[model samples]
Target chain A: MKGIYFLVILALVTAVDIIVPYFFIGGIASLAACYLFWSALTFAVIVFAIIYTSQWGRRS
Target chain B: MKPLYVWIAMLGWTAIALWIAAAARKKMRPGASEFFIGGRRLRGFVSGMTYAATTYSAFMLVGLVGLTYRLGVGALGFEMTYLIFTVLLLITFGPRFWIVGNWYGHITPPELLAHRYKNQWVAVIAAAISFFMLIPYASAQLMGMGFLVDGITGGSIPFMIGVFIMAGLSGFSALYAGMRSVAWTDAFQAVTMMATSIIALLFTLYHFFGSPAMFAAEAARKTPELLKFTWTPELFIGLSLPWAFFALTNPQVSQRMYIPDSVVSLRRMVIYFSLFGFLYTIISTLFGLEAAIVIPGLENPDKAMPHLLGKVPVMLGVIIFVGIFAAATSTLGSIILTLSSLFARDIAKHFYPEIPENTERWLGRIVILLLLGACIVFAWFQPGLITVISSMASGGLLVMAPAIIAAFFWRRATAAGALVSMGLGGVITAVMYLANIYPLGWWPSVWGGAITLLLFAGVSLVTTPPDDADRFISSVERELVARGFRRH
Candidate 1:
């Protein structure tokens, strides 16, 4: 795995995670909206991990 | 809420945990490796469950719930940020740790640093930092247990009794069979934590607000401030920064990257742990919101969950009580086991390189008892800031982050860089925490992390790099591709 790719992706995700919650969702006073956004963000990262590791140990 | 019910439930849980520990000990082989890391033969499920159990603590049901009750949706954001960072770090570093650990037979995280830096002092200092930082975090687990039992039983159980019971159970799991017993019991505890929390959550949703939708609607309507993201930027970053790097910094959980048997098992470990963490974070936060809506106006936010328990049916209250007990005990056991291995493998072996494996193991057992004694004393006073204390531990350990990352990715990184960075950075961060000095309203973690990074890079630029830095990095890189962890 190239370290830079993972680093950039993670940095971007973290930035978005911080900025979106504070800027976009902060004013929305609904639990469902904030809760859904966080759940989706976390779930997306997990899916990315799954896909990223799918190629491991597959070399012939 | 009766002490009798709590006692009976605890007894049944202890019986089951001991039975599992005994079974694990039977299968355990004879060696320091076996004692310290289950001989690195653990399968994916056990590895995943233990990771879940160890990474989480009563901090989830008790501490995090309280944080959410007080702070609102920002609490969920902070926790979810941690989960996101952990999964990313695991995917990036898990295989590297597994490959190096298996090749070098390294039992502790600091040992990995020693090999990379070609200096034993690197390992010793790293281990020392871990020992000093994790004590408060471990004691916070005990205090969580003590407070929960005391709160649920209406103080009939007494705080010290709860503390002693958890410390005793955790101490036994660590001393009995080391990692084998701890991992097995942790797997059991992880299941119990998830299952009980889920059941209680569902019951609360249905009983309190008629359904999940109703619960959400009522939460927004009744406590609109909680639903709104209200945390200040300083507060959010201060709390989330240390926890964000937890998978890479905390020795107790970071050391777990060495346990899975293969690449596939490592993958499974990350996936399982991710799912468990996501679900548990949501459940804990939902309970916090429910408590805010149903049982508002509590003087101490930490008592939110326990107060909510009082409002629930007796059976459900007891079930949630055991869940928090299991969470605290599992986390405490894992920390004790990891610290003992660090003491034995890094410190003891560094002093006496010719020490026999059995002697090292015995020394580890002795350290486990001493660490438990210290934690019990710490818990007895009850800091009452469970979440803050836990975060302080993580922040202190965050000093090691630059050293660890540079070990694999930056060949120019040197021994002086790691030592100066961790040593000085740890001291400054610790002093800041003790003195309650937050420079310019920022947490110590942010300042410590920034200072450590600067020290690591700047010092390495002036100092001599290890002669074998290239060989070490290339060999690991070659193996990564051979093991299919990386593409050519």
Candidate 2:
């Protein structure tokens, strides 16, 4: 169940990561804000990956 | 861009790499296992470095930078999607592969599939697909060197000489002590690659625009289109989907699961590779974005990196050249070494069961020489389609993903299922890519993967599985718990 739950979250995050940047805030005229939003999303994914996998090998 | 500087950088980089290979020969023990996989005893750091070096190639610095230059923020999304999916997939499958590999003493990725399927043909088929797909990919690395040197020196070094120089060094690095030398040199080159690129990036940022903030502002002001996210969903999925499964589909990286010394080492390999990949992706993509601002109006987007180097200080430019060379050479060396192991263990030994281990080891070395020769010919006569071929390499290899995942997870998977899916799906995918045939705006990888999943599942249901499937699954399950992983 935990494994399935983790995979679900991974799938959702991946969908959001790909979908949002290209559709929602990507075409805005404000370059700095748009770039920052995209950059922040990428950093969030990286941080989440680090945190998620850090506990992958730990005893549950 | 002088002949002298190009020669100095190329020669100096080769000498240092060869010296590292020679030094690694002293630490390696006698035997094929030691030669092929460092006796399966590599510590976390070395294992991690080799993984990082093997996975991230010259493609990142040259091809990826070009993509980002031509495309925009969408390039970052495509690349980052790969990283995110790879890290997630690694967390899920890394332990499974490690435990199974350690338990069975599997020497190659194909061997694991062969063992699980209890069929020699599975290994042979997988190796054949890898050899076919990766050679063009490897040739692209050499072509990268040729392009870099030729562009830097204005053709004074000659493209052939540049290709041969990198080929000779790459061949030596792999042939010296096999994986031991390759891993050690890769670690060295990996560090060299990152450090030099970081320095170059900072130099460009500070020297040109005064700071990263300034660089971004200038880029946004100058070429606002390059800062926008404009990649179509089809284009994004087309490029990213294959790489999303890269950690599983590409044997050069998948085989690393068998090299780490323990579960802890395996963990470190994943963590270190993730962080390294994270930082490197940022650097490479940022360099691409910066290149657009500083050196705009280039006719060929692929020449962006070379043009950027031409604009920087000569000393820094020379250092950057060596760094890009290190990137290509490390990639070529690792690919050659891994392919040699695949040929030796999976294809050759499977055909000749009575062949001695000593003969098998020699066979691997011999294959390295031949593979390098093939790659040189391919690179020298460099096809104009190198980029297309390289892009399609991972996409074609995606045909293997369904089969690979089914190995550990799907008990109903049969040898016949794996064979037909990989062989037929790989053929269809390659053909579709080459013919520029996209079905309804979908990439060949998307089509191939969909077809492969259907074939794998459909064929697996009707075909009889090997009798050992239950035992194989149960053993891995039991070992996962024993290795401190909870199933739930």
Candidate 3:
């Protein structure tokens, strides 16, 4: 599950990098999109780590 | 040209930073962990502020601004690249690092490298490169501070005197308080920096254009070239790629992962720091653009910001001076602290295994003083453009970045591969830089980083991974388990 989440985040970031520049979004929108994508990815990973750890503790 | 109010405010701010350092010393422990990583007690806000302060230095304000002035909006690409790289670092490796460093009691990057490779030589080599490359970068910080003081005071303070004062104060602060001192002072400095940026941006907009429509019209009429954003392909790839790579592999930044209080705090900091990096980069670049527009046809592009400050109102000039001082001193404080840690943990521990911790701490203090003196000598003798020194310093470190990343992630990365790639890449980069080989004009960092990555990847594929690869992986996995994070 964690590995899958990581791959999804990676794909989304890669897609944003490719699409944003190709469309020539050069001003505030480009900056906003980049920040939003990065923050969201980071948040998702943190959530996965936390949930995964709690489940492992319960099993043990 | 103005009253002494600006100088007074600058001095007062320095005093406040010094006081904070002094207060933090009371909490300082004699252990290496306390000295280097603040004993892992730093909260999310303090860690975020320190990370931001250390990352945004005189280099960003002075060197980067000068680049933008010369290259126009295209330089924003370099600044934005780091946002992507830093977030990647935070998500992929940040939690693992915090867990390992805490579980294993690691203090420096080399210590972690030693753990992963089980080779003392690898740790020694990485430490040597970090200390040697970072000193020149620290010297550039001193030079930048000197220039800012000279410009703001209208030559009332000589460059050498300014360098001495700033270096001496920062060295003393780091000597007394260690990372604890540096982190708290960074919080204060970060606030001052943000305030100054807001005021400067507003003032610049008001002077140039009262509204968005007016500003656009003025930008179109007066300096349409600034909006064009045409850069050479070589520069587009070489400069931005190396910068992004550096933010991930730079020892100073990696060391931050060791100090956060918990995985929860680290998670919070990653978000705060990324936002801080984005906002500061845009604000600083806009400030640079305004400076370019106001101070047209300046012979020295680096003087654009200082020259613009000169033409502003007295109060505004004072505020900007405070901002520059905060930027310079915060960076200087971090450098001094990091260098001292490198000397004590990597150098002194290797030579004298039985040295007392208290004695070692004082030794670190003495090394800070020596470094300050050395930087003063360099600042006096080799006073040059901040951009040149920055690029050279960065070029040297770029060679190490690839090896560092591979050491942590790629289980097949050998100690031999790490050594060969870093040494060969550094030598080639230096040779190419000297010979003027690259199309965007031979920058040490660009060539060095590219060669390092290629060589490291090639060497890793041809050679077997380190003998202890499985053990190291399990240890990291175990650390994550202990920290409440499950393995994959």
Candidate 4:
């Protein structure tokens, strides 16, 4: 993944992070939904990091 | 609940930390670089652990728990957002900082700014702003210790003693072997922090609600409003904006980007720190929800963790106490060590120019002593808003974000622009924080960030760019491609 691609992905995820919490999760008064959403979001970002950094130090 | 148990636990933990520091000292080499940045040869795991420990402080178990208890699911969102931004920033800036630091022999983040801007005053001013801003942040760490001891022991042990003990141990670790001792002890502390917090969290869940699923059900039913996202957009954005940029703006953690041994190790540092942050954030926030459900109506939200500890078994309570202590001490040690390096290298050595490497190291040691003294005094007062104070410090440091980003990406960024933006923006933000003035119900960080970006870009556009700016950017980009950090 290139830098621009990573930035684009992050921007989209961040928007989801903010919007989902306020708009969707706000109406659900259950801890399960909120916890699941954040955990899944954080896990996804970490996956992206792993993919992006796989070739960081390798010579092409 | 007993003062004796608290003292015994603390003493044992400090002894182990000192032994680790002693071992690290045996491996230490003599020089300014060795003292400040571990000769830039730190292994990946150590690099990652120290980064995690330094970045996530006592604030996690203490301040974050309280925020979660009072506010609700927004706390998790705020913290997770910080983690995501931090991981993204590290992946982006880590290689750049590592390569530039190695090529230029830069010992501190401000020194990198100085070299890129080609102006010593820029580094000096940045270091000064760091000193002015970070003291409160460090004090928040100490304040966490004080509150932990005071709350858990039921005020049997005075707050000042807790404050003094943490300050002394952290100072000793930093002064003994500089980055070597600090980083090694930090690895130990990081492990202790995670283990103890996880054990305590699980026990709390089981002891109170019988299972994780039950705990979630109980929390949702008992405090449904907290499960709902309730923070205002202004509050959420204001609090998170500075922290979102923390990896770039906070000099303590940013300086770690210079210490990895290789590109592979740098990669491990980012990945490990991310995983660690992810787990720790979830645990800390969960503990907050538990506190709200189990013990509600506490006047001071910051007391939630300590109060929860009081309800747990004695052994578990002491274990968690040591964990919070370890967390605070490691963070304080790292901050003190980084700030001292900034003072010695950017401020002291810049003006003197003739100070020997050994003398520079000694100067840093002296500054560590002075810095710890300042933090202890600040913590003595026992600040009320630990989370807010920590955020304000980052907000103040946010003024440098533009200059920092521009250094690697924009050739037109001028030294004068960096100076004007950082200096003016820092002062204005600090004043707003001091004067308690938030214009239009927004945060100083928000306004300060916008103004700083404008100042940096506007000034750089009109001023003469540095002659070496183009060469610096092109060479760094070429090196990035050579190292396979860039695909094309």
Off by over 4 Å in 2: A1-6, A29-46, A52-60, B385-387
- The CAPRI quality class of candidate 1 comes to medium
Question: Candidate 2, residues B2-69: lDDT per residue as tens digits?
Answer: 88988888888788888989999999888778888888889888888899898877788887788878
What is the per-residue lDDT of model 4 for residues B1-488, given as tens digits with 9 covering 90 to 100? 99999999999999999999999999999899999999999999999999999999999999999999999888998899888888888988898999999998999999999999999999998999999999999999999999899999889987888999999999999999999999999999999999999899889889999999998888878999889888888888889999999998889999999999999999999999999999999999999999999899999999999999999999999989999999999999999999999999999988899999999999999999999899989988876679999999999999999999899888899999999999999999999999888999899999999999999999999999889999998888888889988687
Taken over the whole model, the C-alpha lDDT of each candidate is: 0.92, 0.83, 0.71, 0.92
lDDT of 3 by residue, B1-488 (tens): 35367558767888888888888988887687788779988988888888888878887777777776776665665566556656665666776678778778888877777777666666777777777677777888888878777776778877877788789777877877788998898888887888897888788688767854565566556655664445655665566555665555567777888888876667666666776777777777766666766777877767777777788887887887788778788888887787777788877887886888887788888888888887777778755677666666667777877666666567788777787777788778767765667745746677687778888888878988778887776676666556555543
All predictions: root-mean-square deviation over Cα? 0.8, 1.9, 4.0, 1.1
Q: What share of the true interface contacts does each candidate keep?
A: 0.80, 0.30, 0.03, 0.69
DockQ of the two-chain complex in candidate 2? 0.42
What's the residue-level lDDT of B212 in candidate 1?
95
For model 1, state the Cα shift of residue B35 in Å: 0.4
Candidate 3 per-residue lDDT over residues A1-60, each given as its tens digit: 233454576567645544554345333232233333434443444454444333332212
Q: Report DockQ per prediction, comma-separated.
A: 0.79, 0.42, 0.15, 0.68
Deviation in angstroms for B413 in model 1?
Answer: 0.2
Docking class for model 4 is medium
Q: How many clashes would you count in candidate 1?
A: 1
lDDT of 3 at B445: 71
